[model samples]
Target: MLQVRLLGCFALEQSQRDQSAVLGRNGRRLAAYLFAYPNRSHRRDKLIDLFWTESAPDQGRTAFSTALWKIKRTIGASGRQMALHAVGQNVVLEIAKPAIVDAHRFASDIEVALSASCADSIRPAIELYSGAFLEEFDGDWVLEERERLEVLYVRALTLMMRQAANQSRYEDALCCARRILATDPMRESAQRATMLLYTLNGQRGQAIRQFERCRATLREECGVDPMPETRSLDLMIRSGAVFERIPTLLNETFGTGG
Candidate 1:
């Protein structure tokens, strides 16, 4: 039996026993959307509207039907069984039991990692996050899911960095912080974390340089100064008090580190 799972930012296929194939972009998209909204039946008109919004109405309908037929042909008998019922205007795909999807699994694992008491338990979960949800699909239907996944991605990385810091793994924390900042240069939490990691590891000069680069980027791009909290962090570094009161400084900065 083929197990198809979908949750949040992860999607996985188990039991490669079935060699089902979905050919072409539009055909693949139809299958993917149907799989994603398994509980809901979609109207033929609605599917046409979504995928061929820019095409002429008659042409769009023709295209939609062609794609649907392709999906049916690709999955063969399993495809026909998966098709619950298609009345004159609506078609529904049905599963006998709950489907397993990688997106859903990834979300579940991320939630557990977020709530875990130990960082070690969360490490493997973080590693499971391969990439954004449905990286291949760029339709309007997928945008919201992508954004939601991105936020979770950032939060997971942040949690890992904090865990490393708690264990005095400054180098590891620095690497995590840098990765976050690369994705979001304006992420103050990551910037502050990097600064703190540098300071803790006796790389005060590098820490100060990080601040300088951030200041330049913010000024050139946003025409704004760094937040007072980040400025204060730089001050702490200059005064040689960063290591002595690292936690206190982090608490004060809150959201202005990167």
Candidate 2:
């Protein structure tokens, strides 16, 4: 099966073997743009305007043709296999299907996981996500997709952390929560989860430190304070509330008390 993975960057293939040749920066940008807008056909002129915005109209068209040729050469397309089709003064490139792109796969997995009732069934699918859809690409066209995928990634990570906590894998839960917090420090659920994990591990000072750091980050970067829930948790930890309740709560909740 052919896959055109776009995880870290653009890659093309026939079957599992990659047929993608090393493209220069411009060619890579073109490929990234097309992969990002696979469903919609883009006009050659629009692409020229987007990438070669500094060039004159005629020069832009020339540059666009050069980019298209480079892509074709790199992907081993012959003749009209990857040619610009005229469409009312606008030329569009036709992208073929059954293509395995990372963003597509990530979206598919997210949909499946959302539909599935059993969290266990979605674990493997969630694990398939290594990073953001196209972590390196930061073009204006891709920002919306990037934000969407980031939300999905955080939710998947939260689910995984919850599952780990349920399984008494406090260490694993802590690690996953830390990762989520690193990406979005304002994610109160992840922060709460990390605090819970620290309390479970008897790292009271560390738990307090986590809360303090979260508070500092939010204030410094976002000009906001931590949520009431987080502040309450901080107060609880400082007043020995968490430690005092740990034995009974752990026994009743997880059925394992240390």
Best by lDDT: 2
Per-model TM-score on C-alpha atoms: 0.75, 0.79
RMSD of each: 4.6, 4.5
Q: After superposition, how far is residue 230 of candidate 2 from its true place, in Å?
A: 0.9
Give lDDT tens digits, candidate 1, residues 1-258: 344533332222335542324446665667777766675778988888887888899998888887777765544455433554567899776755432445545566777767764456656766655666566677777778667766766777787777677667778888778877866898776777788789888899999999998898899989998888889889989998776886676555333222
Candidate 2 residue 38 Cα shift, in angstroms, is 1.8
The candidate 1 region of ten consecutive residues with least summed lDDT is: 5-14
- Clash pairs, candidate 2, are none
The 0-to-1 C-alpha lDDT of every candidate, in the order given, reads 0.69, 0.69
Output candidate 2 Cα RMSD.
4.5
